[model samples]
Target: MIRRAMVLAAGRGTRLAPLTDTTPKPLLPVAGRPLLEHILEFLHAGGIREVVINLHHLGHAIEERLGDGRRFGLRIQYSWEDPILDTGGGIKRAEPLLGGEPFVVVNGDSLLELHLEDVVAFHRARGALATMVVRPDPEAARYGLIELDAEDRVRRVVGLPPGVEGTFRGFMFPGLHVFEPDIFGWMEPDAAYSVIRTTYVKLLAAGMSVYGFLTPARWVNIDTPRALAAADLTLRTAPFRF
Candidate 1:
C-alpha cells in the first residue's frame, strides 16, 4: 500500500492575484475552510498517513496554518524551498521524505474526487512506472495534450514521441499522479523544472511505462477568482461523496 504522498503547494499563483497577494493559494478558503485543509483531509481519507508539502511564496503562512498536520489525522512535513522549485524540482527536493515506495502526488490548488485505492490498483496492475489520473475534456489540447493508446498507455505528453499515427484518445491531467521512486533518476536535484514538460515527456519518449487512469470524478482547478468561487459553490451544493 502507498502510505506516503506529496502535495505541491509552492507555486506563486500569479493568476489569482490581489487575493493571493496576501494569502497563499493553498490557504485560500473554499467552502468555509482553507483549501489546503480540504486537500489534507482528502489525502487522509484516501489512506495516506504521511504527507510532505513543498512550500514557497508566503510559505511561512502555510507552515503556521497547517503546523504538523496532527490535527488532520496525518503526519505532515514541509520541504522548504528558498527559491521556489517548480513541480519537478519540488518533488525532487522532497525525495528523502517520500521513501522507497511508489507514492502519490497531488496539486494543492485543485479539488478532485477520486478513490486513491482505485488509482493505486490501476497503477500496480499495469506495473507502470507512473500513473496519471486523466479525464476527457474537449479543451484538453489547450491545456496541453496527453495522448493515450487503447491500452491506456501514455503515447505522448505535450506532443512528444512525434510522428506516431493512431486512433488514440487525448485527455487532460488533473494534477494527480502515482509515481515510482525511480522517476527521480531522470531529474537533476535543485533545478527548477516542470514534471509534465520535462520528466513525463522524456519518459514517454523513451517508451517508459507511463499510463493514464481515466476518471469520471468531479474536478476543479482553483487558479482564478471565478474558479475559486465556483469550487466553493459546487462543494456547498454537492459535497464529495468520497
Candidate 2:
C-alpha cells in the first residue's frame, strides 16, 4: 500500500562539480532526459501516484522542468531546501507530504532498475522500520557496505569496521529504500544527517528491523563521469526498461 514516495535530490553534487556548477545532478541528462525524470517515471509505472522531490543546488531549474509533475502523470511536489539539509533532514522536511505510512526514497543521482512493487511488499512483510536495496559485490570497500544476517536482516554497515573476514557478505547500498513514517522519530529536525552515516547504522545498533533486499540482477549507480558513461551504455541493453 505504499503509494507515496520521496526522491532525495537536495545534495550539492560536489563530486560531479563543474557540470553540476550549472545544472543540478538530478536534472543532469541521461539518455537525453533528466535522471530524476526517469526515476519519476519508474515510480509512476510502479503504481506510486504521489512524489515529493527535495531540491537544493540549482533546484529552481528542476522545479521549472518538472513542475507539478503534470507531464509525467504524477502529482509532484517540491521540498525546496534553502540551506540544503542533508538526507535525513530533507526527508524530515517532506514528512508531511509523505503522509502516515511507509514511503519509497530513491537517490536522484543513482540509476537502478528496481522492482518497486516487490520491494514495497517485502518491506511490509518484514515489518522493517526501513528497508535498503543492496547488491552483492567485492567493491563493497569502495562504496559503503551492508552485512545481512542469516534471515536477510541487515546486521551491520561494513565501512571501516573493526575487523571482518572475506568479502563473503560483499554488498553495497544502491541508494534506494522503503521507510515507515515513524522512522523519523530517530531523526533530529534541526540538524542535517546522512542516512548511511547516521540512521542506517543507528538502526542496526538499536536492533531495529532494518532489512536488505538483494537484487538478483545487475544495477548501476552513476556518480563520476566514467560511471555515468557506463550506466548509459548499460541502460541501453538492460532487459527491463524502468
Candidate 3:
C-alpha cells in the first residue's frame, strides 16, 4: 500500500483574485470545512498516512492552519518553493519526502471522490509510468483533451480536437494521479516545468506507459469564484459520496 502522497497546493489562485490574495486556494472553504481539510479527510480514509504539500502563494496561511497535520490524522510536510516551481518542479523538490515508491497525488483545489485504493492497484497492475485519474466532462473542449485507446491507456493529449473520429473519447483530468519513483528521471531537478507540457506529453510522444483510470465518481474543481459557489451548493446538497 502507498503510504505517502503529494498534494499540489502551491499554485497562485489568480483566477479567484482578491479572495485568493489573502488566502491560498487550498484553504478556501467548501461545505463549511477548509478545502484542504476535505482533501485530508479523503486521504485519511484512503489509507494515506503521510503527505507532502508544496507551498507557494499565501503559503504561510496554509502552514499556520495545518501545522504538523497531527490533528488531521496524517503527518504533513511542506516543500517550500522559493520561486514557485510549477507542477513538475514542485514534485521533484518533494522527492525525498515522498520516498522511493509509487505514490498518489491529488489536486488540492479539486474535490475528488473516487476509489483511491483501486487507482493505486490500477497503476501498478499496468506497470504504468504515470496513471492519470480522469472523468467525463462535457466541457472537455475547454480543457486539455485526454485521448485514450481502446484499452484506456492515455494515447494522446491535445489542445485542439483531433478532427477525426475514432475509438477514443476525451475527458477532463480532475487533479488526481499515481506515479512511480523512476518517473522523476524524466524531469530536470529544480527547473520550473509543467507535468502536462514537459513530462506527460513527452512521455506519450516517446510511447511510454502513460495510462488513464476512468472514474464515474463525483469530482469538481473549485477553480474560479463561480466554480466554488457551484461546488458549495452541490456539496451541501449531496455531500461527497466517497
lDDT tens per residue, model 2, 100-139:
8779998998856766888889988998899998887778
Residue 229 in candidate 1, Cα distance off native in Å: 0.9
In candidate 3, what are the lDDT values of residues 12-90, reduced to their tens digit?
A: 9999988998989999998897888989988888889999999989898999999999998899999999898899889
lDDT of each: 0.91, 0.81, 0.86
Each candidate's root-mean-square deviation in Å? 1.0, 2.4, 2.2
Instruction: Output candidate 1 Cα RMSD.
Output: 1.0
Candidates 2 and 3 compared: the better one by lDDT is: 3
**Over 4 Å off in model 2, which ranges?**
159-168, 237-240
TM per model? 0.97, 0.92, 0.94
Is candidate 1 or 3 superior in TM-score?
A: 1
lDDT of 1 by residue, 194-220 (tens): 999999888887889999999989998
In model 3, where do residues sit more than 4 Å from their true spots? 159-167
lDDT, candidate 3, at 179: 92
lDDT of 3 at 73: 89
